[model samples]
Target: MALSPEDKEEYDEQRFAWIGADTVLATKDSDQIDKHLRIIQARVRTKSATAHRAFAISGRAGLGKSTTALTLGKKHERQRRKLLGDGPEVTPVVYAVVPPGATPKMLMRAFATWLDMQVPQRLDAPSITDQVVRVLAQQKTTLVILDEVHNLRTTRSAGAEAASQLKVFTERVDAAFVYCGIDLLTSDLFTGDIGKQVRARTKMYALEPYALGSARDREEWLELVLGMEDLLPLANHPEGSLEDEAAYLYHRTGGSIGSLRGLLGDAAIEAILTGKERVDRALMDDIILDEEAVRHAQESTAPSPTHSRAKKTG
Candidate 1:
């Protein structure tokens, strides 16, 4: 539906709220995260100080892997409420995103900050390890989500070193470790001997994109799709053309939840500019018109990227 004036105003406010939204939105899509979070909740209630489980949230680009991991961490925090009576308590869920070129020391610094520990700007790996261990025990962290942990494997000069460090860390740390990444992480971290050693301690998961095999579910699913018609800024298309366009949309977007919304949004803008009755195929083609269009427009828009320098970089 075309957004009414009031709708537009509401949309603007909600969009503004999401401008710097770092927390997760509770949704069925995040159930995998919830499952682990609930596990932590149960573990917390039991008072067993066993080593935490490793949570793996694997998915393709734009599939909300990091968001889901952060959501799990957030949910784990909610579950910590009843634990207030168990000595000095604090937020149980500690979330961190592992950027490329991050080492154990860097990881420690980031974790320390999240856990609210008095950590210095720089520390050796052993020292950071000591501090993190002490902090986790003290704060009673229920879960530690390390998003984009695939980058950790890329941090070391030698692949074996990276793999070994992860293994050693998991073996030594008692907190639940969550590793979120795309498909390659399993191969990168699970192939060699060290992988076999550490694989059992760590679990893996994938966040698959939304797909509709046919038009049967298209209309119903459209409401849930990320960049679909309701959110698009399209002028009214006369009569029955919108549904036809929606079908074309399914074909073009391969039913991807993220892509379909963007596809419609771009088409809507074109429709408004051209004063067209409906958002048709030709307008969709104009969005990028080719592979480079997608490469440039689609990817540069992600909320999180390993690196982004709008200006020229050497």
Candidate 2:
């Protein structure tokens, strides 16, 4: 039976709401991060007093480093709740982001804010740090995730202080530390003596963008596209709409999951609004993506000068 126009409009609104929310797809990189997080959690639990090892996930922007870390942290929090029972104060995961141009006090305040602790403005950096450390210890927070850690530059005075303070947090609190940031290994965060200390303790996991240079790569890319397509809410969409344009999609997105999400999400919304109820090459071509993805796609597709010369000779 055909529904009323009003009913169809209401249903479309619900679908839009669903499409707006982020959908986390489990990938090989996230799986590795999860395994490492579990190991760190176990070690921290067994040896509470010892300063345990930490890990960092470094990558270019739009490679889903923050998303991967946050998702793992949330998963760990859920597991802890199951084991320890969900108490108001049983926070097994504390997630915070390093503020831009963050000072030591500012960084501590970020943690304090996440833990819902209100520190008076009169308090000094040491006082704020002490308070945050105390609460983290008391709450038995087992995982501390600091995203955008690349912002804590060791070259500048304030950033250096914040980086040192972070080290202190790892020592003072008995939680497994995980840092996520853009291009951290080459950044000033790992350059000095302090950097040596950090580098020695934390393992680095670099998340590279997906490529289409191999058969396996193509297979994985297709699987990812299929997974994303499965989540679309279009009623009249074909099953393999996205898969049919796999190569074109890769050229458009440069295999960055975040960029792909942006492109598909916008296209999906456009499809619903325009009553197309399906995504295809034409619709995606009309959707503009981020500057970086577009630049990358252009670079990837452009013929090399060597190829051009060879074509002329031939």
Candidate 3:
């Protein structure tokens, strides 16, 4: 059955949004997310006065650390509400991004804004911290997930200040924190006095890129590709094509799930805009740097090492 023009246009728009920066898709990394969720829930469930320990999700740009943390926050929010049942709406998890080059004051303001509360003008960092803490308590927040935590590494003093603020939060609030960013454990944010305190308390979890070195890794990578295939709104199915292009896709993306998604997403967009019906090798050729083309170019152009060696011998 043919889709009406209106329906087709809407479907295409929805497909585009599927791969947008804000949209979170569950990948193989979701298993790790499940573990984090369980940890946070345990922290919430435990009644002991034992000091709370935080955890981090660390990875390079494109490993979906931010998405995973944000998604976990949302999931926690829903679970919190459901558990409350007849109780008033309580936000269990608060998600915030550490602004680039943000100071303690700026970080407080960001937190205030994320909570939908106004930051009073001309307030000191201590006052802002108090207000933010009160609000989180009022909202019954159990966890705080800070994304782009590496931004705290702007400088030694800045990193220390940020780490101190976080440490204070852990000391003052009942909430456990989750920090997500790149190489945060090795950053200045984990170095120095206050940083050392935070590093001592928070467990580190690393999210590595998908590897194609083993059969298990390859299967996981292919599962990711198939998951993305289910998102594309192409008239002709593109499921098998991704499996067929597995080697090339892995090579182009270096097994980074984000890069793989971007390559396939951009190709899907091109296919939609050009009315191509579906993604194919030829379509991907135009969108991604074709590996075959690169191989042919390299094979054709360079002076032969064998010939050079023969000439040298002669």
Candidate 4:
């Protein structure tokens, strides 16, 4: 059924609109996500007479670490619920972000809040810790994830204290613990006496960023870009439309998954709004040009000696 010119134009517009607001694609990071899920699932399934062992996953920002953690956590939680089959809301997987400058008391309060339990105002750290354990047990939470754990206070005595509190939490709860943060290997949470104990019990996984200099990385990155191009809404789609711009995209995004998505997302929105059938290098270049201008403006206004000296001489 060949369409008339008007019908083809309308269809292209509709396709553009559909791609404009598409959900985030995580196919590029599936391997990392799968590995993390496997570790969590194994621990969650294991029978434990006492406290379960903990695990740590570390990755830099914009690497989809949190997204991977939350996505897998929710998926397993759903599976656990399905297995129970209306017996109860067995929260087999729980995810929470660690509060900035988190103390033992603050951590407990956050945990309690996540579990829908009341935060006691007058309770000390130990008391709150007990309450959190009880609530987690009652909810049948089998895997607990504490993200951004690097933000927890971990200096001098505070570091040891926080570690001690964490040890206590893991010991008291039967659920396995998973900590997500950046640079965990170098973090204070993995040093000192208590840190040594944590290091001994936990398995560590580090997510590496895509490096443009590596042949394998370039190949993987190109695959990701092409995958995104496939999802772009367009009429009269040309094969390898975005292949040529692969290097440019990598340079612009520093080979980060999050940055690539941002570039593609903006391009898709512009394509829809302008009623264009496809995205091209020119559109993405304009976006990057505008961003560079904004960054330059910010730098120009910053307190630098050259600028300050010029103003004074003027």
Candidate 5:
């Protein structure tokens, strides 16, 4: 049965919203993050003043670092609201993205903006930082997730000051800090004295792309594919259809959850618009992924010396 033009428009809008609201996949990395978050929340509940330990999630782009952290932060906020009720004063989690070339003032402004506080341009960095700290403490913020923390470099004067300000916030705010960034272990954000302090205070968790080398890896990837597939709003989409093409999906996305979400989300939208109402190899082939994912896919498929040797031996 063919739909009317108005119906098609409504369906398209619905599909767009569905795709844009990316589903959170419960992969091992997210589970580990959640476990750490729970421990942090527990410490906060117990009023552990000296337990200023932070959790750091670092990896390559499109590996779901920000999503995992933000999702867990929202979950923590919800749990907090459940206990204390939803009050403006009871902000359990405060999330802010560290802007590129972030100064100490800019970093504090990010927090201030998230908290909907107006900061005067004349205020100095220390003043702004003090205000942010006071507000965060007043709001009773327990978890502070700083995304794109790779931007807070310690090499530059402004960045170093920003890093120092961040440490001060941790010390003063009495909250569990979670930092998310790309390739932070190798990044110079943690160099010299400030780096040593960050390293000592924070526990690092590396979220790597899914690998398809082992049976366990394959199972995990397939499970993620199935989970995402189940969320598609397409009427004619078959069950386990994406699971069947799980290998191809992994090849295209390099097993990055973010990349996988983008690819599937776009493909699903295309399917709805074109009246196919299903995601398949043909539909997905028409979609282009991010440069990083594309490059990773190309490298994964490219024959290597080890692969050539194994093939020859076999």
Candidate 6:
């Protein structure tokens, strides 16, 4: 049986494995990160209640850009919660991974649930916006993290309507959002109305493929890439160290942290299931070349790729 969309997402989170993409993103993509952080710092420091702070974060696929934003959101809120309190004064950090072909109502529904607010039964575009804005005002959220933003584009209106919705949502609210997407020209090459709006509010970060770097940086990055515990099974291999695998792993994932985690995790399990306890370089190679790995993965559990989008149930 095909998994529900919600079930597919849950399964993906549980099975994820590699670290190549995240390592480079956290360590190598310094310039991009600096800019993203700067924007966040600016927003949080705004003194005026009426002044709004908003910006966009765009990176190439396979970079840890989204993860980085999510991390920032998570950490910032944690610190804020400690400094403030657990009550309504705390700035709620909300996250949403926008879906491909998603309408504005769909996006709004996601934000509503993210904030633990009521999801309206009829999620029309206007209602979605009204309800979400009301909830954000009620919860006092200061930061919103939108991951996989490239997926937010839909076949309808070529994303014009959706873009307008986001623009309206971002403009009137005091809250800030860190929007994550693929590299600027390659993935988003933002066109027409949507392009202009994204360009206006976003601080673009172009995350490129990973390259070999300093020894300490590479080691730390690799450990972060594949968690120490995650790499324990590979210790018995004669031909490998986790650090050695990092470079090749980076190439396979094209520097996308999310994909890197999923790819590596998938390879490790495949090796163990095939009677090989050690995840040597070769097994990683098989997974590296296997484009099918990703497809097979989504196929195993996710809903059949839905070209026909479903409207959210009330």
Give candidate 3 misplaced runs (Cα > 4 Å).
1-14, 44-50, 85-88, 238-240, 288-314
lDDT of 6 at 261: 65
Better of 4 and 5 by lDDT: 5
Ranking by TM-score: 5, 2, 3, 4, 6, 1
Model 1 per-residue lDDT tens digits across residues 1-314: 47797986686555434432443433336765676656754554454444445667776665567666676666556667565544455657677766567666666677777777776666676687787777776777767777776666643454455455555665565567777776745546655565665566556666665445656465445545432333444445543445555545544554444455455555665565455725666776777433433443444344455557453210
Candidate 2 TM-score to native: 0.88
Q: Best to worst by lDDT, what's the order?
A: 2, 5, 3, 4, 6, 1
C-alpha RMSD values across all candidates: 9.9, 3.6, 5.8, 8.1, 3.4, 11.4
Q: Score candidate 5 by lDDT.
A: 0.84
Cα displacement (Å) at residue 29, model 5: 1.5
Cα-based lDDT for every prediction: 0.58, 0.84, 0.74, 0.70, 0.84, 0.60
**Over the stretch 83-146, how does candidate 5's per-residue lDDT look in tens digits?**
9889788889888999999998899899999999989999988898888889987888888989
Candidate 2 has an lDDT of 0.84
Tell me, by TM-score, which candidate is best: 5
TM-score of 5: 0.89
If both were scored by TM-score, which would come out higher, candidate 4 or candidate 5? 5
Q: Which run of 10 residues does model 3 get worst, by summed lDDT? A: 305-314
**What is the Å distance of residue 226 in model 4 from its true position?**
5.1
Tell me the TM-score of model 4: 0.69
Q: CA shift at 4, candidate 2, in angstroms?
A: 9.1
How much is the lDDT of residue 71 in candidate 1?
62
Residue-by-residue lDDT tens digits, candidate 2, 101-196: 999999999999999998999998889989998998788788898999988878899999888888877887778899989998887787788888
